[model samples]
Target chain A: MDFRKKLAIEPGSTVSLADINPEQDGGIESKEEGKEKLSGILDEITPLQEMLYAEKKHALLIVLQGIDAAGKDGVCWHVIRAMNPQGTYVASFKQPTEVEKAHDFLWRVHQRVPAMGQVAVFNRSHYEDVLVARVHNLVSKQVWSKRYHEINNFEEFLTENGVTIVKFFLYISKDEQLERFEKRLEDKDRQWKISASDYAERDRWDEYIEAYEAMLSHCSTAHAPWYVIPANRKWFRNLAAADIIHRAMLDMQIESPRPTVDIDEIYRRYHHAVREA
Target chain B: MDFRKKLAIEPGSTVSLADINPEQDGGIESKEEGKEKLSGILDEITPLQEMLYAEKKHALLIVLQGIDAAGKDGVCWHVIRAMNPQGTYVASFKQPTEVEKAHDFLWRVHQRVPAMGQVAVFNRSHYEDVLVARVHNLVSKQVWSKRYHEINNFEEFLTENGVTIVKFFLYISKDEQLERFEKRLEDKDRQWKISASDYAERDRWDEYIEAYEAMLSHCSTAHAPWYVIPANRKWFRNLAAADIIHRAMLDMQIESPRPTVDIDEIYRRYHHAVREA
Candidate 1:
C-alpha cells in the first residue's frame, strides 16, 4: 500500500488518536537507512517542483496542524527547502492582529492561498479556528461546530479552481513532548523558544487531542486529504513528509508548455544562431 | 445635500436609464469652474487617503462599470492618480481564463480585494457576470438571474468586514458613443483602440441599458451603494468621480493611528540631545 494511502485519514471516516501511533516509522529501524531513503526522494522532488513551476497551470497548498513544538518548522526546513524560492512560499499564521480579528477567520487564510503554479505552505492554517478556538472557547460552541462544513466547502471551492491540497497532522507523544521541552530548557540558546505558556497549553492535553480528532475526521475531504505522520522520531517524520509530497507532485501531470511557433522553424532560427556561435 | 447621497443609488429603489440625463453635470457648467471645484476635492482626498493608509483599519473598494469608452480608464487615470501609489492598486477584469471560468464569478474578484488600509479599484468587477453575461446570453437566464442576489451577498460580506464599496455606472448617450467612435477613427494614435467588436456591442445599446437598470435596482444595498454618473463630458466625469470619492473617504472617519510609544519621553530625550549639541 502507498505510504500516503496508509497515513491518509479517509474523508468522513471517524478518527481517534489511539488509532494512530506517534512512534511508528513505516517499519523502518535504522536511522542511517531512513536518511539514505530521504536523500533519494529529495533529489526527485527538485525536478518535479521545477516542472510544476514551469507549467504554471496548477497550485499546491500544504497545511500543517499540530500542537506546539510538534515539528512543523522541521518539516518546512527539511522537506520543502529543496524547491526554488520563487516557486514556493511559506505563510505562517501567528496570533491574529486586531485587523485580522475584524474580518472572518477565513479572510486571512483566503488571502494567503497560492496563485497559479505556486506551492503555499501554511505552518498553522485555518484549522486553528476549529481546534484551538474550540478548545479555548475563543468562539461560541455553535460557531466552532459549524466550521467543519464551512471548511469542507472552502477546500472544495479551491480544488474546483486549479489548487491541490494536502494536510498533515504531525503526531507526537506527550512524554516525548516533555522530553523535548526539558532538552530546550538545558540548552541556553533554545531556552527562549520554550516559554511557560507552552507547558500551560500542555496541561489540557486531552482537550486538544479531542479537537484534533474531530478536525481530522471532518476536514479530511476527497479533494484535500489529511495524513497523520508519526513524529516521535525526527528522521521518520522528515522521510514521511518528503515521500508524500513527492508523490503528490508526480500526480500533478505537470508538463512544460508547448511552443506556440513551429519547432522546426524555431530550430532553423536557432541553427543560424548556433552556426554563428 | 451630501454629494454622495446626491449621486448614490437609493437602496431598494427601481431604476430606469430614461430617468437619467447622460449629459447632466450636477447642474454645473463652465469647464474652468468645474476644474477648480475638482482641484479642491483633490486636495482633500490626498490627506484623507494617507490617514486611511496609516490607520490600517479600513479598506475601500471602488467599482466602475460601463460600456467601452465610457471613461473607465479615464476615471482611473484622473481621480485615482492623486492617492499615494503605495496604498492604492487597480485590477482590471478582462475575459475569464479557463481556471477562472471553473469557479464562481466572484472568485477572481475575491482574490483581488484590498488588504487592510489600502484602496482597490476594479476597472470592471463581478458585475460583468450580471451585465455582459446577461446581454450576450453567455449563460441561461436562470444562471444570470441568480447572480444579482449572489453579488449582493458578496458585497455585503465585504462590507461586514470593514470594506466600503462604491459603484459607478458611467452613463453615455448612444449619439455620444457614435461621436467618440468617429473621433477614434480620425486620430492615428487612437486608431488601434477602435475595434469592430465595439460597434457590434454598441448596436445592442438598449439591451445593455436594460441590464444596467436591473443591476442598479437589484444589487444596490445600503452598505454598497451604486451611483450613476453622467459621463458624456470628460471634465464633469472627473469632477463627479472625485467628489464622490472624497465624500466617501470623509465618511470613513479615517484618522492617523495614535503613537504607541511614550511621546513625552521621546520629546524629553530630543531636548537633552539639543542641549548637548
Candidate 2:
C-alpha cells in the first residue's frame, strides 16, 4: 500500500525531524481545503459514532505518534469530537510513573483499554519504551529491541479479544519543526510549552527517527498498519485522521442491539409524560 | 432567570429530575439534532477559537458539579472536544491522595489552573470540600463553612488576573439516577462502572442535595453563576453545556490577532517554493 504517498510520509527516508524545514517540498498541503474536507467527513460519520455506542461489543483503539509540534492533539479534537461521549475515552501516556515502572510495560495500558462499545485513544502509548527510551539510551538496546515483539503480541491479543487498532505517526520535516518552535518561543502565551526537554530531544532527532523506522519495520502488521502523516500543515493532519477514523468505523458497521422494549412504545409513553406535564 | 425555560436545559428543573420514572416517561429527544446543533456551533465558533489562540490573553475555568449519573463526564467530552488543543486543558478532582490531603484545601487545584488564553475545566472542583465532604461528614462543619469565603476569594483572584469562571451543576432526580444505575447493572459492559461507592453515595441523596443547595446559594456570584442543568436526557445535557460554553466565549468577544505575515506573502512564498521544486 503506498503508505508514503497516502499517509504523506517524509521524503528523506533517513532524515531527522529537527532538520526538515516547513518550506521543504512535498511536506505540506493546502490548509483551507484540508479543513473543509475533514469537517465534511466528520459530519458524515456522526451516525456511525452512535452505532458503535449502541453495538457495545467491539472496542476501538487509536494510537498517535508524532514529533513535538506535529498536531497529534489537534487530530484527536477534530476527528472524534462528534463521537458519543459515553462510549469514548482518551488516555495520555507520559513518562512512566513510579507505579507504572514497577509493573510490566503493558500493565497500566491494559487497564485503560476501552471496554466493549467504546473507543480508547492513546496519545503516546506503549511504543515509548522502544522509541523515546531507546533514543535516549534510557534502556539497554537488547531490552528495547525485545519490546517490539511484546508490543506486537499485545496488539494481537487486543484484536483477538474484540479491539480494533488504528495507528498513526505524524511526520514533519526538521525545518518545519524549528519554525513552529520559533513561533512558540515568540508567543508569550505559548512560551510555557517550551521546555528544556524539547530542546534536548531535538538534539537527538536523528536517533528518534532511527528508532521510529525500526518500530515501523518491526510492528506494522496488517491488523495495525502504521500511517505516517505529513503534519507540517495542521489542517491536513486533522483531515487525514478524520478520514481514517470515518473509514474504520464504517468498516465495522456495528448495529444497535435489539431493544427489549419496542422503541415506538417508549416514544409514545415519553410523549404522554410531556402532555401530562 | 427561569432555568427550566432555558432552551437546552433538559427537563429544566431539579424537581423534574427528581420525579423521573423510566417505565412512565421514556422521554426521548432527537439525539441527532443535539449532535447537529453542537456541530453547527463548533463550526460557527472555529474562527473564535482561532482568535483566542492568537490573542492568548484570557484564561477560562469551567467548573462542573452534579448529582450521581448527572453526566459531567459526558458534558466534558463534548464541550472540551470542540476546543483548540493548544489552549485547552482539563483537571479532574477525585478523593484526595495522601500527598493532596496534607496540603491546603485548594493547593492541588491551584497547580492545575490554565495559563493565559487557555481553558481549564475542573470536574468536581474545590467546592467538593464544602459539598460532598460536608454531606458525608468527612470533615467538620466549621471547616467546611469557612471554605465558601476561601472559594470566593480564590475565584476572584483568578478573575482579576484574566480568568473567567463558568460553573455548572447537573441536576437529576433520584428516580432518573436509579434508572441509570439499573441500566448499568443490566449491561455487562457497563457493570464495571458500577461501584459500592456509587451506591453508598446514593443512599445520602437528600443530604447531598441540601449541601449542593447551600453551596450554590452562598457561592454563586455575579462572576460565576451556577447553571443548574436538567440531565435526565442525554441530548438536553449536551446541548445545555454547548450553549453555556458558546455564551461564555461570546461574552469574551475573542478576536483573532492579525497574522504575523500577510496571507498573500505567505502564499507567494509557498508558490515560489512549489515552482522551484
- Best candidate, TM-score-wise? 2
Tens-digit lDDT track of model 2 for A80-131? 6667444565677889899999998999999888878778778889988889
Q: What is the lDDT of residue B160 in candidate 1?
A: 90
lDDT against the true structure, each candidate: 0.82, 0.71
lDDT, candidate 1, A1-277, per-residue tens = 2679889998899999987899997987699999999999988987777667767799999999888879997787678766654366667787899999999989999998988878888989999999889989999999999999999999999999989898999999998887776565444334446545676688889999999999999889889999999899999999998889988888888776543333333324422322122
Q: What is the lDDT of candidate 1?
A: 0.82
TM-score of chain A of each: 0.95, 0.86
In order, the interface RMSDs are 16.1, 9.7
Name model 1 segments beyond 4 Å from true: A1-277, B269-271, B274-277
TM-score per model (chain B): 0.95, 0.83
Considering the two chains of model 2, state its CAPRI-style docking category. incorrect
Q: What is the DockQ of candidate 1?
A: 0.01
Top model number, DockQ:
2
